[model samples]
Target: MTLETSVGNTQSFGLSSKYVEKWEKRSSIRTRPEKKIDFELDGFFFPEDKQPVLLDGRLKDISIENKSELLIRSLFKYLNDIVTLEIKLINSACNKIIYNDLPVAYPEQIKMNAYTVIIDEYYHVYVARDLINQLKARYPYLTEDALPDSDSFCAVNEIMKRLDAEHHDLFEIIAVCIFETTLVKELVEFFKSESVHPSIKNYVNDHMNDESRHYIYFLELLQYTWDRLPDKARRDIGSNIADFVKMYLNIESEKEFNLNYLDSIIADHEENKQTVNAIYKGFEVTPDVPIVKNVISALKRTGLLDDENVKSGFTNIGWII
Candidate 1:
C-alpha cells in the first residue's frame, strides 16, 4: 500500500493521520552508509563474591523482618518524591515546546488528545511508584528504592540538550523516534518480566499500552521532520542518528553497573554501603558471554537494532565482538 493509504488506515485506529503520514515519509528517506564506532567492554562485569549481596532480596521482600519493612517504607517515600519531581520536569520541558510547534490549524481535539497522552505517561510512572510501595508492604525484601533518580533522568535530558544545541531541528524528531520510542518500550517489557513483583508487572503493563501509542506518535513525527529537511540536513540527521546510536549503546552498557543508582536505595546505614559495594562488585564480573550480545538481540527483536545502516555504522566503529 502507498504511504498515504497506510497512514489513513492507521488513523482509523485512533492515531492522527497527519502524524502517521509524517512517519511514513521519514521511513522512506534514504539512510547514510553505516560507520563502525569503537566500544570497549574490558572491565564490564563485577566480582563473583558480590553476587549474594547484590541479589539480596531481604530489602526487596520486607515482610519477613522489621528492618526490611522499614527499608521498604523508606524506599517508597523516596520513590514518591522522585516521581513527583519527574512529573514536574516532564511537564515543564515538554509542554510549551510541543504546543508551540504544533500546526496553527491543529484541531483542538487532537491537541487535547496529545496532551492527555503526555499526562497519562506522567501518571503511569506515578502509578508504578505506588505499585512498588504496595509490593514493599507485602515483600519488604523485594522492595528497594532502586528506581532511577532525577539525576538519572537528567542524563537523558543532557543528551537531549546537547542534541538540540548542536543539531537543532532534527534533534527532537530523532530523539523521540529512534531513542525514546525504543527505550520506553524496552523499559516497559523489562518491568513486566516474571521476576518483577506482580504489582509492578501490572503497573508497567498498563503503561506499556500507552507507551506503544506514544512510540507510534514519535515515529510519525520523525517521518514528518525528515520529509521537510533539505537533502544536506537529512544527511546530517542520518549522521546524528549514527552518533546517537553509539552514545546510547555506551549509556546502556553502564546501566548494568552504575553506582549512582545505588544512592536511591533506602536500606539501613550499615547495610547500605555494604549492599551497594556488593552490588557494584557483583556487576563487575563479566559473564562468560558478551553483554552486547543480549543488547543486540533485543534491538534485533525490536526491528531497530539490526538495520543495515546501523550495522554498517557499528562495523566501521569496530563494535563487532
Candidate 2:
C-alpha cells in the first residue's frame, strides 16, 4: 500500500477491496517505544553544530555551543507546541467524522476507520504530553508555559467562515487531511537526522509508522467525501484546500505563540531578535522542503489537485512548480 500523490492515481487504479484489507491489518500504536530520553547528550533536542535546524536555515553561523543548546531547547519547545496543536486538531477532526454524518461513500467502513484514527490520534496526544513532561522533569530548562496557539487555525477559519454554515465542517476535515498529509512528509528529515536525539527519533518513528496508515486513511476518506460533494461545494472547498497547504507551509511563526516560546529560549528580547535573524537569515520555502512537496503530492494523489480551481490556486500560491 504505497501511496504516491499524483492526480488520477486513485481512480486510475481504484481503491479496490485490497486497500480496505490493508487498513484492517494496520499495526497498533501500542508498539511505540517507551524508552526514556537521555538528557546527557547536547544534540538530543538541538544540534551541536547549529546547521539550520529543521526548516529554519538561519542558524548556520551562530555556532557557539551555548547558543546551539539554547536553539535546541527552543526547537524542543517548538516541537511540544506543534504536537499539542496536532492533538487538538486531530481530536476535533475525529469527532466531526465519527459523530457527524459527512457524505462519505462508505458509512460503516468509514466510521470504523474513523474510530481507529481517533484512537491513534488520542494516543499520539498522550505520547506528546508524556514526552514534554519527561523533558521538563529531566531538563527543568524546557518550558511548559508555551500555549499551543496556532496561526494556521486562524487562517483555516478565515476561509471556512466564508462558506455557509453547512459546509464549515468540510473545511475542518480538509484541514486535518492536509495536516496529516504534510506532517508525515515534514518528519522524514527529522526521523532520518543522525544529529537528533535518539529518543526524539524513536518518538518520530512511532508517529511515522502510525501516520503512514493515517495518510492512506485520510486520502481514501478525502476521495470518498469528494465523490459525494456537490459541484459548487467541490470547487469552493477544493480551492480552500490549496489555501491550507500554503498556510501551513509558510514556516514562519506568528508573534503569538511560537515566537513567544522562541523569546523565552533566548532569555532576552535583544538576544531573541538576534537569534530570530540568525535562524531565518536565508529563509525561503523552496521545493526542497519536504512539507511543501509532499503536501502537493498528497493533494495530487487525492485527486483534489486535478480540480481546476485547486490546481490553479496552488499554482497562484507557488506551492507547486
Candidate 3:
C-alpha cells in the first residue's frame, strides 16, 4: 500500500482529490440498486464454515432442525455485531476526526474523506439492520436479543487503562486505524462463499466496497499521525500496540460468547448441551492469523514496526513469531 509519512511541502495526504472523487461512483449509498433484493429462505443465512458450531463434529449429531435454527440465529448475531462495531467503535472514531476532537491535526482532505466514511459506515449499519428485520419477518420464531458488547467493543476500556487521559484519543485513533486496516479481509470469505444466499453476498460486497477504501485511509492517517509525534510519544504508543492488539483479539471472550450462544440455542436439550460443552473444552485455541498478519502488515506499511519497542512488543506477545 502506498502511504504518506511526512507532509513536507505537499498539501494533500494520501486521500487526494482523485480518490475522494471515486467515492461518489463507488460507494454503496450512491451506487446501490434501487430495486429491493429478494432472499432465498431455503438457502443458508450464513456460511457454515464461518459458524463454528456448525463445523463441530459433535454438533452434526444434533437434529437438522436444531442446526437450521442455529444458522438463522447466527445471522442475527452477526448483524447485531456489525451494528455494534459500526455505531459504537467505527463511528465514534470518525466523529473524533470530523469534529476536531483529536489531539493531532489532519489535512482538510483527510477530514473530508472521514465525512464520507462516516456516511458509508452509517449506511452499512442501515443495510445490516435492514437485513435483520427482513430475516426476522421470515422467522418470527427465532428471536435474537441484543448481544452484550463484544470483546472488540469493550477492548477500548482495557486498552485505555494503560494510557494517560491525554493520550486517550490518540490511542483510540491508532486502535481504530489497526481495526480498519485489517477488517476487509475478514469480510471477503462471506462475499465469496457460494453456500450463502445471494443477498448475503451482496451485503458483504457492499461492506467490502467501503472497507477497501477505509483501510487505505486509515493507513495514511496512521503514517501521517506517526510522522507528527515526538520520539518519546512514538515510543509510548509503539510499546503499547501489542496490548491493544491482544485485547482487540480477545479469543477467550469470543469463545465464551459463542458457547453461551450455543447453550441458548440448545437450552432444553440437556444431552446435546452437555455434549457441546465437552466438545468445546477440546476445541483448538487459535488466533485469526490472517487478521493479525494484516495488523502486522499495516505496521510495516506505515513503518511503525521499525521502532524496536514496537517490534519487541509484538514479538513478546508472540504475534510476530
How many residue pairs clash per model?
29, 4, 0
lDDT of each: 0.43, 0.63, 0.72
RMSD of each: 12.7, 4.9, 3.9
- Whole-model lDDT, model 2: 0.63
Ranking by TM-score: 3, 2, 1
Looking at model 3, residue 32 earns an lDDT score of 82
Least well predicted 10-residue stretch by lDDT in candidate 1: 36-45
Tell me the tens digit of each residue's lDDT in model 3 across 105-177: 7667777888888898999898888888887887887565535567777777777787777777777777788
lDDT of 1 by residue, 217-309 (tens): 544444444444555544444444444554543433233223333444553655655665565454421212343344344344333343455
Give the true-structure RMSD of model 1: 12.7
Residues 1-321 of candidate 2: C-alpha lDDT, one tens digit per residue: 233222354452113344445545654455545646777754446444443332333444545665645555655655665565566676687778778866543455565667777777777777777777776676676665554445565666677776767777776777777777667655655446666777677767777777887777676666666666777778777777666666666655533343465564446776665655666667666666666777667666667767887778767767554
Candidate 3 wrong stretches, greater than 4 Å: 1-13, 34-41, 55-58, 141-146, 265-288, 319-321
Best by lDDT: 3
Candidate 2's C-alpha runs over 4 A off are 1-28, 40-42, 47-72, 103-106, 254-289, 315-321
By TM-score, the better pick of 1 and 3 is 3
Superposed by TM-score, candidate 2 places the C-alpha of residue 117 at a distance from the truth, in angstroms, of: 1.2
